[model samples]
Target chain A: MKFSPLLDELIRELQVLPGIGPKSAQRMAFFLLERERPRGQRLAKVLDRAMSEIGHCQHCRTFTEQDLCEICANPKRAAVRQLCVVETPADLAALEQTHLYSGRYFVLMGHLSPLDGIGPAELGLDRLAQRLDEEQLEELILATNPTIEGEATAFYIANLARERGVKVTRIAHGVPVGGELELVDGTTLSHSLSGRRPLE
Target chain B: MKFSPLLDELIRELQVLPGIGPKSAQRMAFFLLERERPRGQRLAKVLDRAMSEIGHCQHCRTFTEQDLCEICANPKRAAVRQLCVVETPADLAALEQTHLYSGRYFVLMGHLSPLDGIGPAELGLDRLAQRLDEEQLEELILATNPTIEGEATAFYIANLARERGVKVTRIAHGVPVGGELELVDGTTLSHSLSGRRPLE
Candidate 1:
């Protein structure tokens, strides 16, 4: 029939993760059971510690062990008034890997999806508004993805910032770096053409 | 450049799982941290419970919460003296899903891979041999996979059973059910032709 009760429960719990379906959940459960028991124990410890200790950074809303994230807590980054707004901590981490941005970040943690009951409140727009009011932010960069939901989220945030006398800018939508024009989507190609910059 | 210490540790730990590479590990770690903390906490609890409570069935070497697995402990299945040997618990589960084999199972947990230091001791072949002696088995079915390691393991077990005066049989290797013959590999096609049965 089905797996044992404990194993069934493990598989069920594992499916709570994003992108893990029934098959993947079963594979993961078997993997945990078959491997050295210590590995599963270590995973448990890490999950417990992360759940208990990790929380939203007070300033930027990114995942952090303390009240403020490492980026927010750094004194050197405070003078950089520009704030980059992203949809998730993963996006923030991706941008951090580039080593280009010196300013702070505000993580929405999700994009706007009214159909799925995800709106301003769900995306923590109030907290974002508070951050805008408190900080001397010069230019607000909307670094959310270029999908429909991301566009809606960026537009909403742009309006919010512009109303408060802040300059809001969206990340350029165009053919990706090293991408061929023939391979790029029509919408992206159009955006790239319209937003093309003059070569200095 | 990298995730914070706790997050980094989580990514590394996730990578220990089978099929989980660096990218998947990072995705899982971020997913855990980003989701509701309770979900992660629940996964931790399940992992701990399964790891601590689940152990090998003394008789079959499959995962079980009790001393013997359900298949091994059931008195109804005791009369079925045919033992199907498999390389892993996953294989045993797959066979069980077929509902064709009422016989009991013996899980080697791994195949013979001398290059990887996996041998008889690692697969608990001594226990298998002891079971062969204790049980009045009619037939020993080698259900290990069709890979090189699986073939070697089957051959080794076949010799062990033949020496003990037990009937030994290997599962057929051919074109799978619902498979197109044109797409079937050459080796499989050859095996299918050689193993052709009479239409009685």
Candidate 2:
């Protein structure tokens, strides 16, 4: 009457992923069964390994299989004497793609939101403090999101860095390079105006 | 420098599914890593089983683990003497949900598209012929899509059924129920007018 038991089960399990609805789930299930079985099997193998093996990087707290992530394991990166803090590993990857920062990184995994019971402890502030003490960092960059909780998290981390005599800087806020000035939000425009730098 | 090796592999493998791009794949990987580990592990298990075990039902050609699908295995359905043929399992499910038809089904899995080299053998027309002879089906209903290829497929199957002295019918092409007449496509509106039934 319905899809075979295993097929039905596969469709239901697929809905556990965000943004997958019933129709999309069915399509994905059928697609895998009809044509992409080998790829789907590989996805399963990779997913199993990643879910079981991947854990936080010991030094930077980003998702990794090893005790220390690649960036954290690099002596040259640590010798740069600066640390960039971000809300998620995705943010870290985005910044890394720019190749502008040679310093190390600390990924929060999530921003501070007390209502959801995510605070300094959950953000691994203690580990960050320990790193600051041992690494003797010169500067700390706050590259968390521009939202309220992100700002609050940045402010808290900034205070921690200041107490350790480490200079703290937040990424600049402005109209994005490819964006229209007239289309920019009022608050961002005001921040851009106040934080403006004159040409040499 | 990049996501940890396993995490990177997981993200890449996730993109093997249709409609998942790099960003969405990353999000799905992170989502599974961050909070849905158990569900992710279960998905891996189910996906493995479904990909390895599920195959086309021997009788109906729908995806199923069993040799014959539930409808095809049912004696009462066989005795109904009516057989509805559809393009896919999803289409069969749609008709089943309506509770309008009381018969077994044959799933083509795809329509006739010789330009893509999908010929009679590929559509399992030979198996369909075998079913017509063996099942003693009174009427064969073609529920394929109202597309050029679907029509061609229906016409071919209708010829097959006529050769075996079995009655053949094609589901009507018309303006859809619960749709506005003005917004209906010209082809569908014209078909609806030409295929109009007398109100009793």
Candidate 3:
């Protein structure tokens, strides 16, 4: 059963979002049309504004309205020579939430997926190399996810930074905080044991 | 931790959607800004078009660009005097998917909820009464949900229709198809038992 043309178009458009399928799109469409028209209008306006105004930060490639992202623009963040590289903006945000990382970030936007035609260029490795050459960075922290693509991307970036005479380090992988040893997967448990540190 | 102004505003706008919390909103905002910029722009355009063009159908109060909704505008549907009243456009869409009901529909848009300040007027009871008086409706099928609020709204409409000399009936409440009897809730089990019919 097909919906009205406009409603059908709206549903199709909604499916472009990650993880939203046809069923979810239909539900969202009905929801927008039925009860939350004003909210839908607001969403439309914000989406338009964000798309037109927000672009990749000139320094770190993170989303920003200005030429440089907020973090990149801030002088305090620039004082630190350590640069954290992440697979996406969400990853950067997650690291920022911890408030432990006082340095700047470089968002790769995506990992190297050869099957999907995503390579070093797609992940902006050349631009990153240029940034490393320009900035007097002491440490390069690879904070990509634990996935295969993330590991590959991290390895590629680590090699590039080491060749440029910069100290490169990968974020440690292990059982997460508050995670029970027995509940953690074997791979993670092994990494935790291998990377264990002595109490100061 | 605060996001960039544009990202923060986009996340807040995304939270207006039902079922989207702060975390989900942030994820959606990043997804739109990072890779799916064109899709986000298309969504914005579609939303704007839908909001501005679509309005309540003059006849059934369902969403439509025309004066009457597709179902009400159809000549074949107009021949049927059976009127199925649903609480929202989503409910009407669900019934239409079954392809069993060939009658017209009157969407209430919401149920009677005094706590939320949604009452008879908010549900457009006056317009429904007018429709009932104007049309030669044979059966007024109250297909509102079986929730407490839905039941109250259905009863109110049923009373008004009966007063206007129309045969009013409520949709049957029973165990859903393929539902296990043991797993069924007590209220649903009782309703199914009370509404039991002899096998033909």
TM-score of each: 0.91, 0.98, 0.91
Report how far residue A182 has shifted in candidate 1, in Å.
2.2
Docking class of 1: medium
lDDT score of residue A128 within candidate 2: 96
Considering only chain B, report the TM-score of model 2: 0.97
Looking at model 3, residue B196 earns an lDDT score of: 94
Give one digit per residue, the lDDT tens place, for model 3 in B50-145: 977888888888877778778888999989999999988878988998999998999988899999999999888999999899999999999999
Candidate 2: which pairs clash? none
Rank by lDDT (best first): 2, 3, 1
In angstroms, the error of model 2 at B18 is 0.9
Error of 2 at A73 (Å): 1.3
Checking candidate 1 for backbone clashes, the offending pairs are none
Badly placed stretches (over 4 Å) of model 1 are: B1-3
**Worst lDDT 10-window in candidate 3 chain A:** A1-10
- Per-residue error at B137 for model 1, in Å? 1.9
Error of 2 at B95 (Å): 0.8
What is the C-alpha lDDT profile of model 2 across B45-77, one tens digit per residue?
Answer: 999999999988898898889998888888888
lDDT of 1 by residue, B42-116 (tens): 989999999999988899998888888899888878899899999988888889888999999999999999998
Off by more than 4 A, model 2: none
lDDT of candidate 2 over A1-200, digit per residue (tens): 27888888999999988899989999999888888999999999999999999999998999999999999898899789899999999999999999999999999989899999998999999999998888888889999999999999999999998888899999999999999999999999998999999999
Classified by CAPRI criteria, candidate 3 counts as medium
